[model samples]
Target: MPQLDDGSESVEMSVAMLRRMAEQGVGAVCATSHYYRQQNSIETFCARRADALDRLLVNLPEGLPRILPAAEVAFFSGISEKPDLGRLCIQGTRTLMLEMPFSDWTDLQVEEVSALVLDRGFSVVLVHPERFCSSKGNRQKLRQLEELPVSLQVNAGTLLHWMDRRVGLNLLREAPIPLLGSDCHNLTTRPPNLKEGRKIVIQKLGSAFLDKMDENAADLTRQTANATT
Candidate 1:
């Protein structure tokens, strides 16, 4: 599940929910780092990352989701200066989840993220897209990333969203399907949605796809746990 934009104060609740979900056989979470107020200085961002790590290790229950610290890193020109980039990539993840900016981004922005991932020895997982902004046919845009080995993950909830439901469903039908995440943010408004997402996939796609998600999610967490060790 994606972590919220709350500060260090909310880390405890995040850990608790992760524990509960893990006990119920949900083994992994794509923990987003947007909550650290990264718009502040890099020092502040890294401090929040440290606080999140401390809380995760201390309060995390055994046999729960093996927490993998990641970030929906905002990809822009000066992200190279963001200290949290190194922390998230080196600390727990070989893959960094990046969020596209609100506006249509230049090819240079995508290339920059890909290059950073390579420089840090990390792969990239581009998170929930903003409509046709990143579509496949944008040759010049995609050509910028031709050399980077990246995973493009689309949100399952997008199928239900009013804006991208059709596009989301179409992508779901495509081959080499991307990983599905809950992208969950809050308790009430945008709750952890993997369960509902599972139901949706089973209904629309089939039980076989659901089985794949179950197995894949387990393996992903196990790999992350082993990496952290």
Candidate 2:
């Protein structure tokens, strides 16, 4: 648990983190730790994530947001075919959060991500594409990903930051995004700020937009309320 978030201090991070989410009225939180194919097998990563989550659940703060165990898997070749990939989806759902490659994407790379939807039947959510926004080629590639049954997510910090807000807002205008995340890491610095970000969205995009975002979030985590496993 301490190891998952380098600054977490231990399972106490989970306790403190969720309490903050509760204070903010967050109903669900996706605990998506980083997963790199080059460093570990899916089975090993899933087992370790389960153990970390178990430790957190033992003393999870009462009335806090619901936890959805998942991974922000870094993309790689043939990931769609990973036999244990489904195990990494948010527990009780087929939604998967993915961190795309930092380098310029190749057509094959795009095709494999499409395969994740068309062939593998996984609903892939691309994490924080606004951070990677630039270059017409990349935007075109993202548009291609959008053509599939894929969605993009924007970080709350991206909208809240004065410097990044323009880019963040522009993405909202141009991209097919149905998700917004707190992307909270610790109690301070990169702490949960979904409320603050939503405020910006309300001012810029209106309540109707925020309502749609909340609806999409509910749909994505629908089974979480009833999940026993």
Candidate 3:
């Protein structure tokens, strides 16, 4: 339920957008704005995200899916060692949606994921492996990631051939990609069409795979609630 909003700039989120998302059967969405150290500090990004969430909530129509504040933190060196980085995890959950670098991952980068999982007890959900795992070597690296307690998330638009369809389909067929995100940005560009993605998923992997994905999402939501309480 993580929605990737335009982080570098101000974008309008309307009731129509939420209504469209609701129509797609989305119960809730995490407003995961991009967090890159080069662009802005964590504090500044968080403050902006909070402000945006407050503004959106004030004008939210009745019966629309709730929006939770979060950040899709950009992976960096020594991130696992940064103590305060946990504050950027999805609101109350231990889950962090990590947007991996476009280049091939280094050993230290891979080790950071392990540290985040085993030492810090965080659920590291890697976003859009299809983008990075374009080669056999990269796919092998993805398999290495699977060996850990990490989860993989694919964008719904990718499945619909909006992005690289071949890579997306390759990951869907081969990888244990459990989470399917709409990665919704705005109403015009990347609209929420999870229903379409779900149909594609069901068509390819069957209803059982969709059921398992739902269970995983529910478990993450439960974990978030428990952490808040």
Candidate 4:
């Protein structure tokens, strides 16, 4: 799910992008298109995402990485309480990739995550904490989340850029980061740079760091498979 909204189409997944991911050593990709309540209903978004995936798969060449169904759902009030919220999680998994609000988080917003985890029994993966965790208060909030059953996913692009590289490195050093994603959009703007990102990680933290992350990802995927079976 590299380029959900590539500006050209509603969902812009292509074989070319898949090839690029394969070249970069991406074995599987979760197609997490942006999903906000204001845009459309979950039913509508899932239907559109399914259609886009179908279009991509029908024309897909052999030996490309597998695309998993998921969505990068935007945070909103009372989201956890929604009975159908589980439907928006990554298919066959209880994990939900949440894009936190850009503005200052409210108490209710923070509580929603706790409810999602402790009450709803969902594994919450907060996406790209570097973006919102810039402030001391927000960073503290992320630390609080670590106390709960939550995971942090960093973007490869963040680790490569000079401006955000320190933030990402510091987060990895201080917190428990279990996953890394390209957050790729297209070939031109935000291409798949996972290889370069991995290189940086190895250079800074050694290969063991990446091995741990891979183990965590494997565990998550295995749990998903087990649940489905």
Candidate 5:
């Protein structure tokens, strides 16, 4: 899968980087967000975020990764709150790249978010679930999560950064074919590019798997774009 960070950088920065990477041959991107105002609720953030997206959409580069409105949305207080996720956004496709809290959560909390997504007629795509506080014990919980309508998104950084080889492999082994993403942001330490991440998948999972992942990503992104109307 093409590893890409959710575009949380400023619109100009993100656009420039995305345009540059596309010129360099980047395939797809999963624009994700992690920042949430501690003072303001999701409702407030949603309004501002949507306005920002609306402005950005008015002038995007002609050919960029099917920028999906995805999020590293955290499960706050066991509540998977839904902000104003517009249809054009990737997460608006009833596919939230849900992020669990940094600490462990009860199985009930996991179920709550998963069920909330499905109940809302949307799908949940768990994001880098291996990094959660319950990384060890959460396997069984995640296994149950798979039973629902959800997909797993593994962070390419996990492999590229060598933060946890076993976890990445174990997730690959256990979770359904995961969608790979870079989770990149900024031009410095986190320059936007999927080249290195794609290389790791080719080396570890074979080129065939890599191709299929790319195909799936393309298909989903197209579907996301079509949903914009």
Candidate 6:
């Protein structure tokens, strides 16, 4: 097993994932496992992630897409105060994939994220902001994030779900750095479907917009990879 986040549980799954992503014409991927601060310390989380990555890399099958290790760290009060918070950033870059709180965000919470970007030297990426859209205050806080350096990532399921599709498109329009995620959990029900979201993006935002999105994604990973390699 790869012991990776989402449903990438085994080498067989990796092979399956390669084919699945190929269908979407995706050439590279970020293995962003979840990091729950309540359950583990930074050292513990990194150790586990390293072990899983080692296991996966050792037995990796041929033709697998490039994998960049990262964590989707859940937000908590005073998280920016944690000295090791930078350890959670994506490998080779100071970009943190922040999973914003599901409940209404407070000024303190938003300020902490600001501190991360403005003070702590981190480029924060908010994962699946559409999930928090129902709360009016959350929506406003999302806007507040615009003042700071941040990226908004919408899930593929957002466009896949009819109820969320319109709201997701609107959210993308308001995003500072719009990114899309598959958020695939398993082989069935919830699965890799960035292709579906790409279709929606083209319909709503035009193919050129989606091309820029792809270029943005490529540029980010390529820059980081070049920096480290």
**Which candidate should be chosen as best, given TM-score against the real structure?**
2
TM accuracy, model 6: 0.91
TM-scores, in order shown?
A: 0.70, 0.93, 0.88, 0.91, 0.76, 0.91
Estimate the Cα RMSD of every predicted model relative to the unseen true structure.
4.7, 2.6, 3.1, 2.4, 4.7, 2.5
* Candidate 6 C-alpha lDDT tens digits along 72-145: 89998888888777677777877888998888899999999999888877778899998898899998888999
Candidate 5, residues 1-229, lDDT tens digits: the string is 1222244456777677777678657765666656343544556655555666676677677878555555556666534444344331364354555676666668778768765656555556677776862466676677777777566677777767676856775675565546777666777776754677778878888888778777656544554433322
Clashing pairs in 1: none
Model 4, range 1-229, lDDT digits (tens) per residue?
3234542142344667778889988898777888898887888887877877887777778899988888889998879877577667778888888999998777678889998889888888899888997677777778888888687888989998888888888777665556788887777788788999999889988899989988877765554543321
Instruction: Give me the displacement of residue 16 in model 4, in angstroms.
Output: 0.8
> What's the lDDT for candidate 4?
0.78
Task: Report the error of model 6 at residue 224, Å.
Answer: 4.8
Deviation in Å, model 2, residue 180 alpha carbon: 0.6
Candidate 4 Cα RMSD (Å):
2.4
Q: Assess each prediction's global lDDT (C-alpha) against the native.
A: 0.57, 0.80, 0.75, 0.78, 0.62, 0.80
Model 3 residue 151 CA deviation (Å) reads 0.9
Q: Kindly report which residue pairs in candidate 3 clash with one another.
A: none
Worst 10-residue lDDT window for candidate 1 reads: 220-229
Poorest stretch of ten by lDDT in candidate 3: 1-10
The segments of candidate 5 whose C-alpha lies over 4 angstroms from its true place after superposition are 1-9, 35-43, 54-61, 78-92, 133-135, 219-229
After TM-score superposition, the amount by which residue 188's alpha carbon in candidate 3 deviates from its true location, in angstroms, is 2.0
